[model samples]
Target: MSPTNPSLSPERVRADVAELLGCDPAEIGSDDDLVDLGLDSVRMMTLVERWRAQGATTLEFPDLAERPELGHWTALLTGSAA
Candidate 1:
């Protein structure tokens, strides 16, 4: 599902991350652990870079990796984090 604000869908975000990491988008689950998926610091940075390319100005990898859930990341993307 996408955010209520509808800037982008969780699937789209997952696809973008998968493309940046050179993996299959289907492999990333809403609750999967990114660190367990081999998303090291470098990979996290790569994710941030990709996010920037997609127009996210305030996202940081550490924040996303801390939770690594589609819901959490989607909230961040939508600036719903408080």
Candidate 2:
């Protein structure tokens, strides 16, 4: 699912990331580089699996690891990225 997919939401993405970081979703900024927040490969792979289960089957670790930004990830997962 993508573009019109209803499974992935920015809030959910933020929460997932926040959970892995052991922080509150509200503390995460959309443009913040998650890698700087300590989002290593292990957590990134976990997100890939989680988003896949949510129907973001197109999501991959490199797609996120390359940029590691919350806003960009939301776009990718929601299929709004250019």
Candidate 3:
């Protein structure tokens, strides 16, 4: 199943990231750097593919990797980012 919800919340993003990292959702801070948390290129690409398949087609691995933070990703996914 897709990690993102239809509402596209930051919490969902955090949960997805936590799952990928084999951690808890609470462990993933909204502003935490995923790369610093062991999020490598392969995992990042996997997330991109999964999210894209769930309709986040504009999501790019580079974009996510550039700033691997749940808050920013949530904003991008929900069209709330500047």
For every model in order, what is the number of clashing pairs? 0, 0, 0
- Candidate 2 lDDT at 23 equals 98
* CA RMSD of each candidate after superposition: 5.1, 2.8, 4.7
Best by TM-score: 2
lDDT of 2 by residue, 29-81 (tens): 88899999989999999999988888877676788888899888888786553
In candidate 1 the C-alpha lDDT for residue 76 amounts to 70
Per-prediction TM-score = 0.66, 0.87, 0.79
**Candidate 3 local lDDT, 2-37, one digit each (tens):** 233356656666677789899988877778888898
Model 2 stretches with alpha carbons more than 4 Å out: 1-4, 79-82
Instruction: Compute the lDDT for candidate 2.
Output: 0.81
Candidates ranked, most accurate by lDDT first? 2, 3, 1
Stronger candidate by lDDT (1 vs 3): 3
How accurate locally is residue 19 in candidate 1, as Cα lDDT from 0 to 100?
74
Number of the top lDDT candidate: 2
lDDT of every predicted structure (CA atoms)? 0.66, 0.81, 0.73
Candidate 3's C-alpha runs over 4 A off are 1-7, 80-82
Better of 1 and 2 by lDDT: 2
